[model samples]
Target: MSIQEARAATEQYLPGLIAELKHQGLMQLEHAEPAQLCQLFRRSNAAGLLIPQQYGGLGASPRDTINVLRAVGSLCPSLAVMMTMHHHTIATIVQLGGIIPAAEDLLRSIANNQLLLASAFAEGKPGSPIFNSSLKASAVDGGFVLRGTKKPCTMSHDMDVIVAGVACTDTGGVDHQGFAVIFAEGANITREPFWKTPILRATDSNALIFNDVFVPDEMVLLAEGANAEEIEASAQEASISGLCWFQLMVGASYLGAASALVELLVCKRGVQDTHLAQLAIELEGAHQALLGTAGTLEQRQEADAGLYSQALCSRFSVQAAIERASNLAVELLGGMSFIESEQVSYLLAASRAIGFHPISRTAAAPTLADFLRNTGSTVDAPEPAHV
Candidate 1:
């Protein structure tokens, strides 16, 4: 669908989600049981919120996804984050083209059943790189046997799919990074609870241990050898587009948290106009950055190295703006904001999750600095996948 149509369509789901939130209330929502939270989202049709209509989802574009996520964050940060994890996996798979027939059917199930996909990508032991993995995905006869663990796998309780990023080896022992989408009930998958914080207590961020899990050939998406430059190029295109969407959606999720505080500030303590105005400008800048990046994807410019740099840089900026806005709202609202409401504390913590994801400013700084000194302008990089 066209972007305008996608925007209009996604906007329709917000009222229902918001209405459900109001009925649930902040205190109850903040303290909801995991089962209740899952049911609430299901009743609110939250699972398919970002999926396109063709596949049985809301069919939201990046712009609309941002808008909807921001709105969701205003009321419920946990839900917002859970949705981001869900959308990131699904959207990335969709972005990275070349899905097999089985994967296609799984997407249909996602769209039709509103079933969730807990992201098992970019996760590993302490200090492990996000993209690199150590999963033992040994290429067997017609498929591969995977043995590893996915830490902090969100949506563990209710997800219908387990999409993990793994390092694969061919018979020739050549290595490649590929995504594995397995049915949630697929054999040999065990769940281990690991989250200890009460802030996002309801998110099912746990360990998913895969022991001799056989992933059939149809469920894998991998890049070919360097010799097949055409295939490799296509994989790179998918990777860049997928990463851009993942980063932008994450920023949107937190922006919702910041916006929640802003809404609260607007309703009470009417004298802090200056801080509010400054925050408004920052929010506007973030929105424009998101809008421009979405437009780039829509225009099919995902193959450009400059776009990768731009998208990653934009995510960092968006994150900083959201944190600044959240802090401003907290200051204007004063200590009582946190002292009076448990909800406020939740909002503050949620907004601070900016650096938790991969490619944060701290992680991407050296590359960004290199880009400035050697890559000329911000829009001229030639290595999309690396950037």
Candidate 2:
């Protein structure tokens, strides 16, 4: 089906989700049970939100995907945030193409069966400073044996599949780099409880331990050579769509959370408060900027390195605006607001999540600065690390 037809069909699913969550008192429920939420997601057909149409999924366009997530976030921000990692991982795999035989099968499986693929990629690893992992892939007769721990993989407990990047030394002794996805119910994988953050309590962002896991040769996607010069050259190229799409989609989720409160303020005060009105305007601007970026990306046929900066800058902009809006919302509503409803309070906490994903404001500064100075300048990204 065409992208337009796919979008129309997907739109039919959104309002029902919003209404169902609200009806079940699941919207903004504190400490939501993960299993129940996952089941709701399954019933809603949300697992196929980004999967391709030919593979039996909705195959929503980038902008359409973000819009759906944004709508979902307006009611249930936890599910929205938890699933962002799922979309991010799949989008990156789709961008990387069929180079990884494993990724190809995994994507089709996600589409056909509506699988929840959790991210087991590295974070907080020392030295690499990127999403680079300490996992070493040893060459076996038919596949490679990988061993390492991925810090804080989102949806660790509920995911059917796990995807992560690793450093592998090939038969030639050259360090080849690629991402690996494996079904999570297998024996080689171990999930640890690590996500203790109260705000995103439902995210289940835990640790994943890989023990002598065997990844067949077909599943290892080779993207970049593991060398300083090769990495500096190709990093910006891969950064094109994978991470930019992430920033845009994730930023929208947080914006939806803050937008909920903004609507409440308007309903209560109706612009009598000039300061709150101004904040509302800023929120609108941020939302529009994100929408425009998503549209621009959806129309692109090839990855543009320049867009990396645009997407990051837009994400941080949305992040700051949501934070400001969240604070203003509380202040305008006053102590009575806190006493009457805890929604705004939880939203304020959720707004902080805009900065949790990497290429965070601090990390993106140098890359953005370099991109501004020269679009030709290569900015090494944190994920899809060559080494």
Candidate 3:
């Protein structure tokens, strides 16, 4: 389906969201902290799109979720990126629903209140594992005390809750990799300016500092492992679902940005049919690849390394397609459009951000290679090669 069709589907799911976001004006949406766009998203109850109906969510399917993200990305890339973080965090929590205590209550609260959740799993350090947190948690009588920082935490300003990866030490001194849920109301939690990039300034991807923040025992989800490697192993398996959703949605988000540029070219008369066809083939091919992977994920009973690999493959492909499509669109749109308005340049730059997400092509190459070599073998999180 075309990007227009995707927007139509998104309208069906999140009615008037596109119009509301577009009404904010592109400059305002891109240059300022997306408070209004975020508010509009919450008002539309888009936060619950992935949550189950029982949890006060819309329970939208994977395809619908992808379409909505793509449409939103076309309008506001920052909002789409923020939504990816929120929805994937929701997806991960949902996967752990059977184990997390009072998860139902948490899900219901998020859905009903339209609360925004920000993920602080990425350390933003080269060669660092996204699942491994520099944030350390020391076991306490009732809970754990956390200390460290997570930079470039998207939606930092508007998030009601922050889910962060941490290195937790038990009373016995056994260290485990885990996730800690910290409320934004925590007195010890603070934020600093981190994202200086003008391109995605609206995302509010700032540095989140946890200064002796206390997290209740129930708020921490520790993997079933005693040490670093084992913890990573267990966490890796659990991460497949979240990673798959993240890559697919993020890829679609950037694809949507590229599609926006392509739309402009299509609107301009006298554009060559061959040039238009090339853009369509690249974009639509990537879109279908995402759809195919999403269909597979939906049919599966559970997530595995194999599906995660497929998702990554699709995401990387989409990344390439987005770059190519965006460049081609800009060239066809001519120099006047490029010099007169920031829209074309903005979309072109934003679409390129797909390459900056976690598990970069270089980081994932070794693991993917191993998986490709032995299809029966489980994919492992290899030490990322320095790029």
Top-lDDT structure, candidate number: 3
The TM-score leader among the candidates is 3
What C-alpha lDDT does candidate 1 achieve relative to the native structure? 0.72
User: TM-scores across all candidates?
Assistant: 0.87, 0.86, 0.92
Question: What are the per-residue Cα lDDT tens digits for candidate 1 across 275-338?
Answer: 7679788777787787788778767735455676777788888888988888888888888777
CA lDDT of each prediction against the hidden true structure: 0.72, 0.71, 0.84
RMSD of 2: 7.6
Candidate 3's displacement at residue 34, Å, is 3.0
The residue-by-residue lDDT of candidate 3 on 1-387, one tens digit each, is 478788898888888888887788656788865676568668988989999999999998888888888888888888889899999999887876765576678899999999999998876766555576779988788878999989889887788888888887666777777877888874488889988779877888899888999988888877644555654554566578888999999998888889888988888999988998899899899999998898898899468988988998999899989988998899989999999989988998899888788877877888688779887555676898998
Q: Which 10-residue window in model 2 sums to the lowest lDDT?
A: 1-10
- The runs of at least 3 residues in candidate 1 whose Cα sits more than 4 Å from the true structure, single-residue gaps closed, are 1-11, 124-129, 224-230, 301-303, 370-387
Residues 129-169 of candidate 2: C-alpha lDDT, one tens digit per residue: 33466677777888778898887777778888777777777
Lowest lDDT sum, 10 consecutive residues, model 3, at 224-233
Error of 3 at 300 (Å): 0.4
Better of 1 and 3 by TM-score: 3
Q: State the lDDT at 310 in candidate 3.
A: 92
Which residue pairs does candidate 1 place in steric collision? 51-59, 52-59
